[model samples]
Target chain A: MQRDALIGEPMVRLTGVAKRYGGGVIALDTLDLDVMKGEFVALLGPSGSGKTTLLNIIAGMTPPSRGSIHIAGDDMTHLPPSKRNLGMVFQNYALLPHMSVYENVAFPLRVRKLAEKDIVKKVEAVLDLVQLGHAKKRLPRELSGGQQQRVSLARCIVYDPSLILMDEPLGALDKKLREQMQSEIKRLHKTLGTTILYVTHDQEEALSMADRIVLFHQGRIVQQASPADLYFKPRSVFAANFLGASNILSTTAVGDGIAQLKSGETIRIGSGAAVINNEPVMILVRPECLRIERYDETSHLSAANSVPGQIVSSTILGNVTNHHVLIADGHTVMAQELTRRTAHDWVPGEQVKVTWAAADTRALEPDEMDVHS
Target chain B: MKETAASASHSTWITHCANAWAWFGYAFLVLPTLVIIPMSFNSTDELAFPPDSFSLRQYEAFFLKGDWLSSTFLSFKIAIATAVLAVVIGITAAYGLARSSFPGRGAIVLFLLSPMLVPVVVVALGLYLYFATLGFSGSALPIIVGHTLVAIPFVIITASSALRHMERNIESAAMIMGASPFQVFRKVTLPLLRSGIIASALFAFLISFDEVIIAYFVGRAGFSTLPVKMFSTIQWEISPVIAAVATLLTILSTGICILVTIIMDRK
Candidate 1:
């Protein structure tokens, strides 16, 4: 998915949006975001990061206090949700409990005053698309969680809105079902080619499902890019820490693309990584990038940096084994290894060396420690 | 182990005693009302339990005698009016109090429910004095107004509870799916709340039908409700017809209560 390929009017646009509650609590600050046509953009963040609020504003359920909303080049700030010509799926799969699946799916068309024959045709097609055609006569409560979610998806797409807003629509399901629904939603998006603005706090869900991931923290977007870019080239400490497991080591820039850690270990920083003069910056090294070697073994691989440490703890997580190595007082770097590649399980208190390539380390200004942490 | 066994047996005995006490309380509350059914069919003019030769004469008197039919009609009309009025006011107030917050919301809810907490005698006396001073005495409108005040609290409680349990996102889902606010209320909110609203209406009807204190105080001679007429009859004479009327009222109330219970259970 190339940003340059999405060359048209944005499906949804927000210019300088802000939301302030009573007693001067800011839920969102001067946010400018453009969701391109037919793009699957995810708003990902922790709880209370204004991602849900932004979704509500786009859905027209909540009015932004300061900014204008435009959908498909039409001003929609003053319009209600019904007039926005958008579809939304809620976290709880907010299907009408009193209506059967057929009636629930027909609700949008009925409200639109579509012809009855056409409505039946479209609804049946959508139900079959979501593989819920057999459950049409059943009420929402009679269906399982995944089935109800499918009905909600059917209802949302039956009307064929230009943009679909999903607010953690798979959050209520178990892990297996959630993953199944994720692929189901991605398939729907590909089939329909409708722009989607998905709000989720699950980083893996966003990373796996979205074309673009917009990271939010404290009422503002910290960074927005492709999933790989966000994971590999994050601009801020918060962005790096929020997207994945990161070992942040405090370092002082020694000019050029080099920084020395507080423990006197010098590490090469990736080119184009931002470095501030005479100020402390943080080096973000992902756990997967670190390779653990016994202290006595000669380095066989070419890597830019090596740090001495002893294994303090290790976690076996099915496919991967995570070893936490303490290189200095209160500074531990996590190294992840594939379980099959390990000759034997490394015991705690074993001496080891953690190595990484220079390109894997991102130099970032030590700003914005995680509020949640 | 022996001490534990002894304590378990003691708790079992306490449970049995509690069940017996509950049954006794139920009998004490219901036996007096049960006595009126047989007396309603008494062949003799005197009101007696275990009637001396059961007959329908008391029921006939209740149906065919002085001012009884008209008073019953008046009571039905007032109860219907109260039910309708209370439902309208109560559902609106419940929605407002549930959805939005502003200064004095708690105070408003307390004031709306104050009628149920205040003594009936005090409320009746206050309305009587207020109506007397305003030259508004002796009208069906006053009785309807008084009954609505008594019924509104029940309506609000039932509707608010239903509103509380309802997922607010269901309404938002409708709104985002191209339904207007009015359509959302009509198609989503109202249909989902059908059983609850029906239960509330039934409660209001029953409350207004059985109300005696306010009807006695606010009603005039010509516009007297059924309970008001029954009260005056009991004061003046021990008529067996009063038993028949009591039996009829009891049956109507019990049937309505069963209906309400069924409706609420469905919700």
Candidate 2:
């Protein structure tokens, strides 16, 4: 939420980081990253995408095969985890089973040989911060899953580490509890002013909670940008598809700011340096950006990219209706429309027109798309 | 409804069969021990199960004999040393095997557990020959060493199982919380493994206390263990006093086993 206050020195920096297991499994490629002081960054990716490996590298749990890591202006590439002075929250909470909540939170301070009074005060403060003050005497197994996670969080913050790394910390929780913890973590970050690096496969969580998102695919970082920038201007097809629902169409550049879809329909787009005449390109349009109208109604037309298609299927998803339309070349383009009381229900096999503003469409270089199937 | 009722009756019959088999098994195993208990109280000097009269005469003989008391003390000293040595080596080996991966890990594990797999008689003979060559066959040293070797596997087994049950990330979490390696082991790993360590130590003690073949081969004159003494006594003369010692050994082992079971269940 404090997006304007991100201008500061780099708290953590990774240069040309890579990791390769003995079995030739490439967990991370040459990667460079920087985290500003007090910034909340999310590493968003699918499983096996190396987000966890990157987090572990920063935590000094796993050393990078090649490259150096600098944290708070110190070279820490070979430092052990104990000397890194970073906090981590595992997906399973990883609370000490034999210790009470209070002892679990006080473990870090005790390891530092802090004074007894200071340790007690810090433990109490963190427990209160997480709203677990009443349950400090309870064992980890005696608490609920969410409460155990809160205890893990409290333990992480009690020592006041400069950075906290979370690896899908909310993955084990249900939707409601996950959302609640997300806000709780965000509140903690705001109040503590510690830099955070979060790793998760959930796009919505990253979008809602992160100031910047670094998207990974197949051990490589695809793009790193602000949440709004990532959603609106993805640099590659993977980023476009991973961020949200996107309708992609193969097109060829015909003129300035104009491209012709395979269906022989010309559509205007915001041209970029990559757009050249007679070159093949891929156009990405968000499902929400495409508007569907009955084919017979053409009088209220505006200067926009439009295509005529036949509705293949329509799904009503409470408050929004998704229409899948097949164009002349048999390419399917999806359009999402908000449901209204007076709106017409367009059933399957109905002829319709899909339209969107030129600014809403993005043209990606054809080679940038990684065909998954 | 009829099918459901028929299936329920069928399951009940199977349960009844299983229960009958279990009771028979228990009785078969326990009948010998029960006979020994009665014979331990025999008034006559003969080793008969159905005694003509019951008395504590055999127990009195066991406690009064100088040879029996000295052998018992020697066995206690050797078993205690074996247990301590076994636990020290076993805990370190188990931790290494559980935490690290290196070349020949599987082979090393098999080697550590090879004593349990080999026939005890073979191991006893091998140990006897080796100790004879080392001039240690007549002393308590060879017996203690052999017992320690045999007990190490059990300790490793119990300790390794406990280590496996622990979540590895707990150690990583401790490390990330700024705990040194020694601190992590002492504060996190050791406390979590308390019940397991204690249980394994008890097992080692019992194994060393009850071992017969190795002790028989390695025992020297004036240093025979309790089992060796009993064996010699039975070969020369069938003493009823052996029954009393057997009953006492049974009680000690059973008490230890129950204590281990309770500790494991608590965890």
Distance from true location, Cα of A306 in model 1, Å: 1.1
Flag regions of model 2 displaced more than 4 Å: A1-5, A271-273, A299-301, A366-373, B1-19, B137-139
Error in Å for residue B92 of model 1 = 2.0
Clashing pairs in 2: none
lDDT of 1 by residue, B1-267 (tens): 999999999999999999999999999999999999989989899988678798999889988988899999999999999999999999989988998889999999999999999999998998888877876655688888899999999999999999999999999999999999899989998888888889999999999999999999988769888999998988999999999999999999999999999998975
Cα lDDT tens digits, model 1, A209-249, are 99999999989887789999999888778888888898888
Error of 1 at B27 (Å): 1.8
Q: Candidate 1: where is the Cα deviation over 4 Å?
A: A1-5, A271-273, A313-315, A328-330, A341-347, A369-373, B1-15, B133-139
Q: Give the count of colliding residue pairs in each prediction.
A: 0, 0
**All candidates' TM-scores?**
0.95, 0.95
Query: Which pairs in model 1 have colliding backbones?
Result: none
Q: For residues B61-153, could you state the per-residue lDDT of candidate 2 as single tens digits?
A: 889965888888998999899989999999999999999999999999999999999998899999888988889644689999999999999
The worst-scoring run of ten residues by lDDT in candidate 2 chain A lies at: A364-373
| Candidate 1 - chain A - TM | 0.95
